[model samples]
Target: MQHSKLLYEKGILHNKKMLTQSQYSNFKFVARLDQIKTFTAGIKALLFAEHGAFMINEDGFTCTVEQGKCIQASLFMMPACFSEFYVDGVVHFNVNMNVLNECLSIFAGIDCTMKMLYKGPEAPLILVLEPQDECEISTECSIKTTAQEEPMEYSLDDNSSSLNVIFIRGPDLSNIFQEFDKSTEELEITISPRRPHFKIDTLGVMQSESSIEVAKSSDMILMFNCRETTKARYKSSLVRMTQKALSVASKVAIKTDLSGLMEMHFMLQDDSQAEVYIQFFITPLAEMD
Candidate 1:
Protein backbone atom coordinates (compact mmCIF):
# COMPACT_ATOMS: atom_id res chain seq x y z
CA MET A 1 0.00 0.00 0.00
CA GLN A 2 3.03 2.29 0.35
CA HIS A 3 5.31 3.49 -2.46
CA SER A 4 9.01 2.80 -2.14
CA LYS A 5 9.91 6.45 -2.51
CA LEU A 6 13.46 6.16 -1.11
CA LEU A 7 14.47 3.40 -3.49
CA TYR A 8 12.94 5.16 -6.48
CA GLU A 9 14.53 8.49 -5.57
CA LYS A 10 17.95 6.88 -5.28
CA GLY A 11 17.54 5.04 -8.56
CA ILE A 12 16.44 8.25 -10.26
CA LEU A 13 19.37 10.29 -8.88
CA HIS A 14 21.86 7.64 -10.02
CA ASN A 15 20.50 7.73 -13.58
CA LYS A 16 20.09 11.50 -13.67
CA LYS A 17 23.68 12.00 -14.84
CA MET A 18 23.29 9.48 -17.65
CA LEU A 19 19.85 10.47 -18.89
CA THR A 20 18.31 13.83 -19.73
CA GLN A 21 15.68 15.28 -17.41
CA SER A 22 12.90 14.54 -19.89
CA GLN A 23 14.17 11.05 -20.68
CA TYR A 24 14.58 10.08 -17.02
CA SER A 25 11.09 11.26 -16.23
CA ASN A 26 9.48 9.31 -19.06
CA PHE A 27 9.83 5.68 -17.86
CA LYS A 28 10.69 4.41 -14.38
CA PHE A 29 8.96 1.53 -12.58
CA VAL A 30 9.59 -0.21 -9.28
CA ALA A 31 7.40 -2.88 -7.69
CA ARG A 32 7.87 -5.35 -4.86
CA LEU A 33 5.77 -8.41 -4.18
CA ASP A 34 5.64 -10.48 -1.02
CA GLN A 35 3.31 -13.01 -2.63
CA ILE A 36 5.23 -14.12 -5.71
CA LYS A 37 2.44 -16.51 -6.66
CA THR A 38 0.07 -13.61 -7.31
CA PHE A 39 2.36 -12.09 -9.93
CA THR A 40 3.17 -15.45 -11.51
CA ALA A 41 -0.48 -16.43 -11.75
CA GLY A 42 -1.27 -13.27 -13.73
CA ILE A 43 1.65 -13.69 -16.14
CA LYS A 44 0.81 -17.34 -16.72
CA ALA A 45 -2.75 -16.51 -17.73
CA LEU A 46 -1.59 -14.47 -20.74
CA LEU A 47 1.28 -16.73 -21.86
CA PHE A 48 -0.53 -17.77 -25.03
CA ALA A 49 1.80 -15.27 -26.75
CA GLU A 50 5.53 -15.26 -26.10
CA HIS A 51 5.86 -11.48 -26.33
CA GLY A 52 3.58 -8.89 -24.71
CA ALA A 53 3.52 -5.18 -24.02
CA PHE A 54 3.77 -4.18 -20.33
CA MET A 55 2.04 -0.93 -19.36
CA ILE A 56 2.78 0.40 -15.88
CA ASN A 57 0.96 3.27 -14.18
CA GLU A 58 -0.28 4.45 -10.80
CA ASP A 59 -3.23 2.07 -11.08
CA GLY A 60 -1.07 -1.06 -11.37
CA PHE A 61 0.56 -3.31 -13.98
CA THR A 62 -1.06 -4.53 -17.20
CA CYS A 63 0.34 -6.90 -19.84
CA THR A 64 -1.37 -7.12 -23.21
CA VAL A 65 -0.98 -9.79 -25.89
CA GLU A 66 -2.49 -9.78 -29.37
CA GLN A 67 -2.85 -12.63 -31.86
CA GLY A 68 -3.68 -12.84 -35.60
CA LYS A 69 -4.72 -9.17 -35.40
CA CYS A 70 -8.12 -10.41 -34.32
CA ILE A 71 -7.85 -11.38 -30.65
CA GLN A 72 -6.30 -9.49 -27.75
CA ALA A 73 -5.97 -10.43 -24.05
CA SER A 74 -4.76 -8.42 -21.06
CA LEU A 75 -3.88 -9.27 -17.44
CA PHE A 76 -4.26 -6.49 -14.88
CA MET A 77 -2.58 -6.47 -11.46
CA MET A 78 -3.78 -3.87 -9.01
CA PRO A 79 -1.58 -1.94 -6.55
CA ALA A 80 -2.99 -3.98 -3.67
CA CYS A 81 -1.32 -7.04 -5.11
CA PHE A 82 2.10 -5.56 -4.52
CA SER A 83 3.81 -4.64 -1.27
CA GLU A 84 5.55 -1.68 -2.87
CA PHE A 85 4.37 -0.20 -6.14
CA TYR A 86 5.62 2.97 -7.83
CA VAL A 87 5.70 4.35 -11.34
CA ASP A 88 6.78 7.61 -12.96
CA GLY A 89 4.00 8.62 -15.32
CA VAL A 90 3.01 5.89 -17.75
CA VAL A 91 5.63 3.44 -19.01
CA HIS A 92 5.29 1.10 -21.99
CA PHE A 93 7.71 -1.63 -23.07
CA ASN A 94 7.77 -5.13 -24.52
CA VAL A 95 8.99 -8.26 -22.73
CA ASN A 96 9.37 -11.97 -23.35
CA MET A 97 6.53 -13.39 -21.25
CA ASN A 98 7.81 -16.96 -21.33
CA VAL A 99 11.18 -15.97 -19.93
CA LEU A 100 9.60 -13.77 -17.28
CA ASN A 101 7.28 -16.56 -16.21
CA GLU A 102 10.15 -19.01 -15.94
CA CYS A 103 12.19 -16.59 -13.88
CA LEU A 104 9.38 -16.02 -11.45
CA SER A 105 8.67 -19.72 -11.11
CA ILE A 106 12.30 -20.60 -10.42
CA PHE A 107 11.65 -20.54 -6.67
CA ALA A 108 8.31 -22.23 -6.97
CA GLY A 109 6.71 -24.01 -3.97
CA ILE A 110 8.68 -21.75 -1.69
CA ASP A 111 8.00 -18.42 -0.01
CA CYS A 112 9.91 -15.75 -1.89
CA THR A 113 9.86 -11.96 -2.19
CA MET A 114 10.44 -10.19 -5.50
CA LYS A 115 11.64 -6.72 -6.46
CA MET A 116 11.24 -5.51 -10.04
CA LEU A 117 12.89 -2.40 -11.46
CA TYR A 118 12.94 -0.81 -14.90
CA LYS A 119 14.90 2.38 -15.43
CA GLY A 120 13.82 3.16 -18.97
CA PRO A 121 12.89 1.66 -22.33
CA GLU A 122 16.50 0.79 -23.11
CA ALA A 123 17.25 -0.94 -19.81
CA PRO A 124 16.55 -4.61 -19.17
CA LEU A 125 13.84 -5.69 -16.72
CA ILE A 126 15.66 -6.49 -13.50
CA LEU A 127 14.18 -9.02 -11.06
CA VAL A 128 15.50 -9.79 -7.59
CA LEU A 129 14.12 -12.78 -5.71
CA GLU A 130 15.03 -14.07 -2.26
CA PRO A 131 13.58 -16.97 -0.39
CA GLN A 132 12.02 -16.10 2.92
CA ASP A 133 13.15 -19.31 4.56
CA GLU A 134 16.61 -19.35 3.07
CA CYS A 135 18.85 -16.46 4.03
CA GLU A 136 21.98 -17.22 2.01
CA ILE A 137 20.40 -17.96 -1.36
CA SER A 138 19.07 -15.29 -3.72
CA THR A 139 18.66 -14.83 -7.47
CA GLU A 140 18.90 -11.86 -9.81
CA CYS A 141 17.65 -11.96 -13.38
CA SER A 142 17.93 -9.34 -16.13
CA ILE A 143 15.63 -10.03 -19.04
CA LYS A 144 15.93 -8.23 -22.35
CA THR A 145 13.27 -5.68 -23.25
CA THR A 146 12.30 -4.19 -26.58
CA ALA A 147 10.60 -0.99 -27.70
CA GLN A 148 6.82 -1.16 -27.78
CA GLU A 149 5.08 -1.07 -31.13
CA GLU A 150 1.64 0.29 -31.92
CA PRO A 151 -0.90 -2.15 -30.50
CA MET A 152 -4.02 -3.22 -32.31
CA GLU A 153 -7.24 -1.41 -31.36
CA TYR A 154 -10.31 -3.56 -30.56
CA SER A 155 -12.82 -1.81 -28.31
CA LEU A 156 -16.61 -1.92 -28.41
CA ASP A 157 -18.54 1.32 -29.00
CA ASP A 158 -20.67 1.86 -25.92
CA ASN A 159 -23.11 4.12 -27.78
CA SER A 160 -23.85 1.54 -30.48
CA SER A 161 -27.51 0.63 -30.92
CA SER A 162 -26.91 -3.12 -31.06
CA LEU A 163 -24.96 -3.36 -27.82
CA ASN A 164 -25.79 -6.23 -25.45
CA VAL A 165 -24.48 -6.99 -21.96
CA ILE A 166 -24.64 -10.08 -19.75
CA PHE A 167 -23.31 -10.63 -16.25
CA ILE A 168 -22.83 -14.10 -14.75
CA ARG A 169 -20.87 -15.77 -12.03
CA GLY A 170 -17.45 -16.96 -13.17
CA PRO A 171 -17.95 -20.60 -12.23
CA ASP A 172 -21.25 -20.85 -14.05
CA LEU A 173 -19.85 -19.34 -17.25
CA SER A 174 -16.68 -21.40 -17.01
CA ASN A 175 -18.76 -24.56 -16.83
CA ILE A 176 -20.22 -23.78 -20.24
CA PHE A 177 -16.81 -23.42 -21.82
CA GLN A 178 -15.52 -26.56 -20.11
CA GLU A 179 -18.38 -28.59 -21.50
CA PHE A 180 -17.65 -27.50 -25.07
CA ASP A 181 -16.43 -30.13 -27.48
CA LYS A 182 -12.71 -29.81 -28.08
CA SER A 183 -13.11 -30.72 -31.74
CA THR A 184 -15.27 -27.69 -32.41
CA GLU A 185 -13.84 -25.08 -34.77
CA GLU A 186 -16.39 -22.29 -34.40
CA LEU A 187 -18.43 -20.92 -31.50
CA GLU A 188 -21.71 -19.09 -31.97
CA ILE A 189 -23.18 -16.93 -29.24
CA THR A 190 -26.80 -15.80 -29.25
CA ILE A 191 -28.51 -13.31 -26.95
CA SER A 192 -32.23 -12.62 -27.17
CA PRO A 193 -34.98 -11.11 -25.08
CA ARG A 194 -37.20 -14.15 -25.38
CA ARG A 195 -36.92 -17.61 -23.88
CA PRO A 196 -33.44 -19.16 -23.83
CA HIS A 197 -32.16 -15.64 -23.30
CA PHE A 198 -28.51 -16.70 -23.75
CA LYS A 199 -27.25 -19.60 -25.85
CA ILE A 200 -23.90 -20.94 -27.02
CA ASP A 201 -23.56 -23.24 -30.01
CA THR A 202 -20.53 -24.98 -31.43
CA LEU A 203 -19.84 -26.73 -34.72
CA GLY A 204 -17.43 -29.63 -34.71
CA VAL A 205 -15.24 -31.05 -37.48
CA MET A 206 -17.40 -34.15 -37.76
CA GLN A 207 -20.44 -32.19 -38.93
CA SER A 208 -21.88 -32.33 -35.43
CA GLU A 209 -23.15 -29.48 -33.29
CA SER A 210 -23.63 -28.79 -29.56
CA SER A 211 -25.74 -26.20 -27.82
CA ILE A 212 -26.10 -24.86 -24.26
CA GLU A 213 -28.83 -22.51 -23.19
CA VAL A 214 -29.34 -20.35 -20.10
CA ALA A 215 -32.60 -18.71 -19.20
CA LYS A 216 -32.95 -15.17 -17.91
CA SER A 217 -34.44 -16.46 -14.68
CA SER A 218 -31.51 -18.77 -14.05
CA ASP A 219 -29.80 -18.21 -10.70
CA MET A 220 -26.38 -18.05 -12.36
CA ILE A 221 -27.28 -15.11 -14.58
CA LEU A 222 -26.94 -11.91 -12.57
CA MET A 223 -28.09 -9.50 -15.27
CA PHE A 224 -29.15 -9.69 -18.91
CA ASN A 225 -29.81 -6.72 -21.18
CA CYS A 226 -30.42 -7.14 -24.89
CA ARG A 227 -32.01 -4.60 -27.22
CA GLU A 228 -32.69 -7.27 -29.83
CA THR A 229 -31.68 -10.71 -30.96
CA THR A 230 -27.89 -10.69 -31.50
CA LYS A 231 -25.61 -13.46 -32.62
CA ALA A 232 -21.92 -13.72 -33.46
CA ARG A 233 -19.48 -16.41 -34.45
CA TYR A 234 -15.84 -16.59 -33.36
CA LYS A 235 -13.02 -19.06 -33.59
CA SER A 236 -13.40 -21.62 -30.83
CA SER A 237 -9.65 -21.77 -30.26
CA LEU A 238 -9.40 -18.03 -29.75
CA VAL A 239 -12.24 -18.00 -27.26
CA ARG A 240 -10.75 -20.86 -25.24
CA MET A 241 -7.67 -18.79 -24.45
CA THR A 242 -9.50 -17.48 -21.39
CA GLN A 243 -9.44 -20.82 -19.59
CA LYS A 244 -6.55 -19.85 -17.35
CA ALA A 245 -8.31 -16.73 -16.13
CA LEU A 246 -11.72 -18.34 -15.92
CA SER A 247 -10.36 -21.01 -13.61
CA VAL A 248 -9.60 -18.36 -10.99
CA ALA A 249 -12.16 -15.68 -11.64
CA SER A 250 -15.09 -14.99 -9.33
CA LYS A 251 -17.28 -13.06 -11.80
CA VAL A 252 -17.40 -12.29 -15.51
CA ALA A 253 -19.11 -9.77 -17.78
CA ILE A 254 -19.86 -10.45 -21.44
CA LYS A 255 -20.44 -7.56 -23.87
CA THR A 256 -20.91 -7.19 -27.61
CA ASP A 257 -21.37 -4.22 -29.93
CA LEU A 258 -23.06 -3.71 -33.28
CA SER A 259 -19.97 -4.82 -35.17
CA GLY A 260 -20.02 -8.22 -33.41
CA LEU A 261 -16.83 -7.42 -31.50
CA MET A 262 -16.98 -9.37 -28.21
CA GLU A 263 -15.36 -8.36 -24.94
CA MET A 264 -15.15 -10.50 -21.77
CA HIS A 265 -14.13 -9.10 -18.39
CA PHE A 266 -13.04 -11.51 -15.64
CA MET A 267 -12.55 -10.59 -12.00
CA LEU A 268 -10.13 -12.57 -9.79
CA GLN A 269 -8.87 -12.28 -6.25
CA ASP A 270 -5.35 -12.89 -5.06
CA ASP A 271 -4.17 -14.43 -1.79
CA SER A 272 -5.01 -11.25 0.15
CA GLN A 273 -8.43 -11.04 -1.50
CA ALA A 274 -7.35 -8.07 -3.63
CA GLU A 275 -9.21 -7.92 -6.90
CA VAL A 276 -7.37 -8.56 -10.19
CA TYR A 277 -8.76 -8.59 -13.71
CA ILE A 278 -8.31 -10.21 -17.13
CA GLN A 279 -9.92 -8.97 -20.36
CA PHE A 280 -10.28 -10.55 -23.78
CA PHE A 281 -11.40 -8.89 -27.03
CA ILE A 282 -12.30 -11.09 -29.98
CA THR A 283 -13.48 -10.18 -33.49
CA PRO A 284 -16.22 -12.23 -35.06
CA LEU A 285 -15.47 -14.57 -37.92
CA ALA A 286 -16.43 -13.31 -41.36
CA GLU A 287 -19.72 -14.51 -42.71
CA MET A 288 -19.63 -17.05 -45.55
CA ASP A 289 -21.41 -16.16 -48.75
Candidate 2:
Protein backbone atom coordinates (compact mmCIF):
# COMPACT_ATOMS: atom_id res chain seq x y z
CA MET A 1 0.00 0.00 0.00
CA GLN A 2 1.08 3.57 -0.64
CA HIS A 3 0.32 6.81 1.20
CA SER A 4 0.18 10.36 -0.19
CA LYS A 5 0.08 13.83 1.38
CA LEU A 6 -1.41 17.03 0.00
CA LEU A 7 -1.11 20.60 1.22
CA TYR A 8 -4.03 22.98 0.73
CA GLU A 9 -3.72 26.63 1.77
CA LYS A 10 -6.55 29.11 2.19
CA GLY A 11 -8.76 26.60 0.42
CA ILE A 12 -11.85 27.96 -1.32
CA LEU A 13 -13.78 25.20 0.45
CA HIS A 14 -12.64 26.50 3.85
CA ASN A 15 -14.24 29.79 2.84
CA LYS A 16 -17.41 28.60 1.11
CA LYS A 17 -20.97 28.34 2.46
CA MET A 18 -20.47 25.12 4.49
CA LEU A 19 -18.82 21.76 3.85
CA THR A 20 -21.07 18.70 4.04
CA GLN A 21 -21.36 15.46 2.08
CA SER A 22 -24.73 16.37 0.58
CA GLN A 23 -23.54 19.83 -0.47
CA TYR A 24 -20.03 18.77 -1.52
CA SER A 25 -20.51 15.74 -3.75
CA ASN A 26 -16.83 14.82 -4.13
CA PHE A 27 -15.51 14.59 -0.59
CA LYS A 28 -11.95 13.27 -0.62
CA PHE A 29 -9.08 13.04 1.89
CA VAL A 30 -5.48 14.16 1.41
CA ALA A 31 -2.56 14.33 3.83
CA ARG A 32 0.81 16.10 4.04
CA LEU A 33 4.23 14.43 4.26
CA ASP A 34 7.93 15.24 4.63
CA GLN A 35 9.36 13.05 1.84
CA ILE A 36 7.33 9.84 1.64
CA LYS A 37 5.84 7.21 3.96
CA THR A 38 5.99 3.96 2.06
CA PHE A 39 4.19 0.72 2.85
CA THR A 40 4.63 -2.71 1.33
CA ALA A 41 1.79 -4.30 -0.61
CA GLY A 42 -0.76 -5.90 1.75
CA ILE A 43 1.23 -4.68 4.80
CA LYS A 44 -1.88 -2.89 5.94
CA ALA A 45 -1.85 -0.73 9.10
CA LEU A 46 -1.00 2.44 7.19
CA LEU A 47 -0.76 4.96 10.00
CA PHE A 48 -1.18 8.68 9.24
CA ALA A 49 -0.22 10.70 12.32
CA GLU A 50 -0.71 14.40 11.75
CA HIS A 51 2.49 15.95 13.11
CA GLY A 52 0.70 18.39 15.48
CA ALA A 53 -2.48 19.77 17.02
CA PHE A 54 -5.21 21.64 15.06
CA MET A 55 -7.49 24.60 15.54
CA ILE A 56 -10.14 26.42 13.52
CA ASN A 57 -9.49 30.15 13.43
CA GLU A 58 -12.17 31.73 15.57
CA ASP A 59 -14.86 32.21 12.91
CA GLY A 60 -13.43 35.20 10.98
CA PHE A 61 -10.02 34.21 12.32
CA THR A 62 -6.83 33.09 10.52
CA CYS A 63 -3.71 30.99 11.17
CA THR A 64 -0.68 29.29 9.57
CA VAL A 65 0.90 25.84 10.11
CA GLU A 66 4.57 24.90 10.14
CA GLN A 67 4.68 21.28 8.90
CA GLY A 68 1.61 19.17 9.86
CA LYS A 69 -0.82 21.64 8.36
CA CYS A 70 -4.13 19.93 8.39
CA ILE A 71 -7.77 18.89 8.51
CA GLN A 72 -8.74 15.28 9.09
CA ALA A 73 -12.28 14.71 7.75
CA SER A 74 -13.94 11.40 8.43
CA LEU A 75 -17.49 10.26 9.09
CA PHE A 76 -16.49 8.88 12.49
CA MET A 77 -15.27 12.14 14.00
CA MET A 78 -17.23 15.40 13.91
CA PRO A 79 -19.63 15.79 10.96
CA ALA A 80 -17.86 18.89 9.72
CA CYS A 81 -14.28 20.15 10.22
CA PHE A 82 -12.44 23.43 9.41
CA SER A 83 -9.04 25.10 9.69
CA GLU A 84 -7.72 28.68 9.41
CA PHE A 85 -4.62 30.30 7.91
CA TYR A 86 -3.27 33.42 9.58
CA VAL A 87 -0.52 35.67 8.25
CA ASP A 88 1.41 35.27 11.48
CA GLY A 89 1.75 31.45 11.68
CA VAL A 90 -0.86 29.11 13.15
CA VAL A 91 -3.50 26.65 11.96
CA HIS A 92 -6.88 26.65 13.64
CA PHE A 93 -9.18 23.64 13.36
CA ASN A 94 -12.63 23.24 14.84
CA VAL A 95 -15.88 21.27 14.80
CA ASN A 96 -19.29 22.44 15.95
CA MET A 97 -23.08 21.82 16.22
CA ASN A 98 -24.23 22.48 12.65
CA VAL A 99 -21.35 20.54 11.09
CA LEU A 100 -22.26 17.50 13.19
CA ASN A 101 -25.84 17.44 11.88
CA GLU A 102 -24.63 17.79 8.32
CA CYS A 103 -22.27 14.90 8.96
CA LEU A 104 -24.92 12.63 10.48
CA SER A 105 -27.38 13.55 7.77
CA ILE A 106 -24.97 12.36 5.08
CA PHE A 107 -23.88 9.16 6.82
CA ALA A 108 -27.13 8.02 8.47
CA GLY A 109 -29.41 9.67 5.93
CA ILE A 110 -31.24 11.04 8.97
CA ASP A 111 -29.92 13.70 11.30
CA CYS A 112 -30.50 12.13 14.76
CA THR A 113 -27.95 13.91 16.89
CA MET A 114 -28.39 16.22 19.91
CA LYS A 115 -25.02 17.37 21.32
CA MET A 116 -21.20 17.07 21.86
CA LEU A 117 -19.66 19.39 19.34
CA TYR A 118 -16.04 18.27 19.01
CA LYS A 119 -13.51 21.01 19.87
CA GLY A 120 -10.16 19.49 18.90
CA PRO A 121 -8.44 16.70 16.96
CA GLU A 122 -7.51 13.39 18.55
CA ALA A 123 -6.42 9.87 17.71
CA PRO A 124 -9.20 7.77 16.26
CA LEU A 125 -11.27 10.96 16.25
CA ILE A 126 -13.79 8.59 14.79
CA LEU A 127 -13.76 4.79 14.70
CA VAL A 128 -15.25 4.56 11.20
CA LEU A 129 -12.42 6.11 9.20
CA GLU A 130 -10.20 3.38 7.68
CA PRO A 131 -7.27 5.34 6.37
CA GLN A 132 -5.38 7.51 8.89
CA ASP A 133 -4.98 5.81 12.25
CA GLU A 134 -3.89 8.50 14.73
CA CYS A 135 -4.56 12.24 14.37
CA GLU A 136 -2.39 14.85 16.07
CA ILE A 137 -4.00 18.03 17.41
CA SER A 138 -2.08 21.24 18.05
CA THR A 139 -1.98 22.59 21.59
CA GLU A 140 0.05 25.83 21.53
CA CYS A 141 -2.52 27.77 19.57
CA SER A 142 -4.67 30.90 19.75
CA ILE A 143 -7.76 32.31 18.00
CA LYS A 144 -6.47 34.60 15.29
CA THR A 145 -9.92 36.04 14.59
CA THR A 146 -13.64 35.37 14.23
CA ALA A 147 -16.29 36.20 11.67
CA GLN A 148 -19.41 38.22 12.41
CA GLU A 149 -21.71 35.38 13.43
CA GLU A 150 -23.17 34.81 9.98
CA PRO A 151 -24.56 31.29 10.43
CA MET A 152 -25.43 31.89 14.04
CA GLU A 153 -27.70 29.42 15.85
CA TYR A 154 -31.29 30.32 16.55
CA SER A 155 -34.45 28.39 17.62
CA LEU A 156 -35.13 28.63 21.34
CA ASP A 157 -34.71 24.98 22.34
CA ASP A 158 -32.25 25.10 25.21
CA ASN A 159 -31.28 21.59 24.13
CA SER A 160 -30.95 22.65 20.50
CA SER A 161 -32.17 19.22 19.40
CA SER A 162 -33.72 20.80 16.36
CA LEU A 163 -30.23 20.75 14.92
CA ASN A 164 -30.66 17.06 14.22
CA VAL A 165 -32.61 18.63 11.43
CA ILE A 166 -33.42 18.30 7.76
CA PHE A 167 -33.51 21.35 5.53
CA ILE A 168 -35.54 20.30 2.46
CA ARG A 169 -35.62 22.46 -0.61
CA GLY A 170 -37.70 22.43 -3.81
CA PRO A 171 -40.00 19.67 -4.84
CA ASP A 172 -39.99 22.21 -7.64
CA LEU A 173 -36.49 20.79 -8.26
CA SER A 174 -35.28 24.35 -8.17
CA ASN A 175 -32.42 26.20 -6.51
CA ILE A 176 -29.13 24.73 -5.34
CA PHE A 177 -26.28 26.04 -3.24
CA GLN A 178 -20.58 24.53 0.78
CA GLU A 179 -17.45 25.21 3.74
CA PHE A 180 -15.33 25.85 6.86
CA ASP A 181 -15.43 29.62 6.71
CA LYS A 182 -19.14 29.15 7.23
CA SER A 183 -19.73 32.79 8.07
CA THR A 184 -22.01 32.76 5.03
CA GLU A 185 -22.87 29.07 4.98
CA GLU A 186 -26.61 28.57 4.65
CA LEU A 187 -29.06 25.67 4.43
CA GLU A 188 -31.94 26.02 1.97
CA ILE A 189 -34.89 23.70 1.51
CA THR A 190 -37.47 24.67 -1.09
CA ILE A 191 -40.97 23.37 -1.70
CA SER A 192 -43.41 24.00 -4.50
CA PRO A 193 -45.64 26.99 -3.79
CA ARG A 194 -48.25 24.59 -5.08
CA ARG A 195 -47.61 21.79 -2.57
CA PRO A 196 -50.11 21.58 0.28
CA HIS A 197 -49.29 20.89 3.92
CA PHE A 198 -45.74 21.87 3.10
CA LYS A 199 -43.91 23.98 5.65
CA ILE A 200 -42.53 26.12 2.89
CA ASP A 201 -40.72 29.17 4.22
CA THR A 202 -40.69 31.55 1.28
CA LEU A 203 -38.70 34.00 3.36
CA GLY A 204 -35.78 31.68 2.61
CA VAL A 205 -33.14 31.05 5.26
CA MET A 206 -31.73 34.54 4.72
CA GLN A 207 -32.69 38.11 4.05
CA SER A 208 -32.86 37.59 0.27
CA GLU A 209 -33.39 33.81 0.30
CA SER A 210 -36.35 31.43 0.65
CA SER A 211 -35.97 27.95 2.12
CA ILE A 212 -37.90 25.36 4.15
CA GLU A 213 -36.97 23.29 7.16
CA VAL A 214 -38.17 19.69 6.89
CA ALA A 215 -39.93 18.83 10.11
CA LYS A 216 -39.37 15.60 12.04
CA SER A 217 -42.24 14.53 14.20
CA SER A 218 -42.67 11.87 16.88
CA ASP A 219 -42.35 9.43 13.97
CA MET A 220 -41.69 10.70 10.44
CA ILE A 221 -39.87 13.59 8.73
CA LEU A 222 -39.48 14.75 5.16
CA MET A 223 -37.21 12.03 3.74
CA PHE A 224 -36.91 12.94 0.07
CA ASN A 225 -37.74 15.44 -2.66
CA CYS A 226 -38.92 14.85 -6.22
CA ARG A 227 -39.29 16.91 -9.38
CA GLU A 228 -42.54 15.50 -10.76
CA THR A 229 -45.78 15.69 -8.76
CA THR A 230 -46.69 12.18 -9.90
CA LYS A 231 -43.40 10.73 -8.69
CA ALA A 232 -43.77 12.44 -5.32
CA ARG A 233 -47.27 10.95 -4.95
CA TYR A 234 -45.97 7.46 -5.62
CA LYS A 235 -42.99 7.91 -3.34
CA SER A 236 -45.13 9.22 -0.53
CA SER A 237 -47.21 6.07 -0.75
CA LEU A 238 -44.13 3.84 -0.56
CA VAL A 239 -42.82 5.74 2.45
CA ARG A 240 -46.12 5.15 4.25
CA MET A 241 -45.76 1.48 3.39
CA THR A 242 -42.19 1.35 4.68
CA GLN A 243 -43.19 3.13 7.84
CA LYS A 244 -45.82 0.43 8.25
CA ALA A 245 -43.28 -2.35 7.66
CA LEU A 246 -41.25 -0.85 10.46
CA SER A 247 -44.29 -0.28 12.62
CA VAL A 248 -42.58 -0.97 15.93
CA ALA A 249 -39.99 1.55 14.70
CA SER A 250 -42.61 4.30 14.92
CA LYS A 251 -43.02 4.14 18.66
CA VAL A 252 -42.42 7.92 18.86
CA ALA A 253 -39.28 9.50 20.30
CA ILE A 254 -40.59 11.41 23.28
CA LYS A 255 -37.47 11.01 25.41
CA THR A 256 -36.03 8.11 23.48
CA ASP A 257 -32.49 8.19 22.11
CA LEU A 258 -32.56 7.58 18.37
CA SER A 259 -28.99 6.14 18.40
CA GLY A 260 -28.40 4.10 15.22
CA LEU A 261 -32.06 3.26 14.83
CA MET A 262 -33.32 6.36 13.03
CA GLU A 263 -33.96 5.73 9.37
CA MET A 264 -35.56 7.92 6.69
CA HIS A 265 -37.22 6.30 3.68
CA PHE A 266 -37.54 8.11 0.32
CA MET A 267 -38.95 6.86 -2.99
CA LEU A 268 -41.01 8.39 -5.81
CA GLN A 269 -43.37 6.59 -8.17
CA ASP A 270 -46.35 8.00 -10.08
CA ASP A 271 -48.89 10.78 -9.47
CA SER A 272 -50.80 8.66 -6.97
CA GLN A 273 -48.67 8.35 -3.82
CA ALA A 274 -45.12 9.67 -3.50
CA GLU A 275 -42.99 10.37 -0.43
CA VAL A 276 -39.57 9.94 1.13
CA TYR A 277 -38.28 8.73 4.47
CA ILE A 278 -34.99 9.82 6.02
CA GLN A 279 -33.51 7.41 8.54
CA PHE A 280 -32.52 9.19 11.75
CA PHE A 281 -29.82 7.68 13.93
CA ILE A 282 -28.65 9.44 17.06
CA THR A 283 -25.09 9.35 15.83
CA PRO A 284 -22.13 8.80 18.14
CA LEU A 285 -21.02 12.02 16.48
CA ALA A 286 -21.66 15.74 17.13
CA GLU A 287 -21.65 19.13 15.40
CA MET A 288 -19.75 22.28 16.36
CA ASP A 289 -19.25 25.92 15.35
Quantify all predictions' global Cα lDDT against the true fold: 0.82, 0.22
lDDT of 1 by residue, 1-289 (tens): 0113333354633442223344435449878788687567667888999798999998889899988788888988888888777789898999999999888888875868887879887888878787878756767777899999757878877887788999999999989899988999999999888977999989999969989999988999999988888888999999999888888888889999657889999888777677678999989998921
The TM-score leader among the candidates is 1
lDDT of 1: 0.82
Task: Compose the digit string of candidate 2's lDDT tens values, residues 46-160.
Answer: 1121121233222222111111211111111111121211112222343332332232233232211111112222312211111222232111111222222222111223253
The TM-scores of all predictions, comma-separated, are: 0.87, 0.18
User: What is the TM-score of candidate 2?
Assistant: 0.18
Give candidate 2 regions above 4 Å deviation: 1-195, 201-289
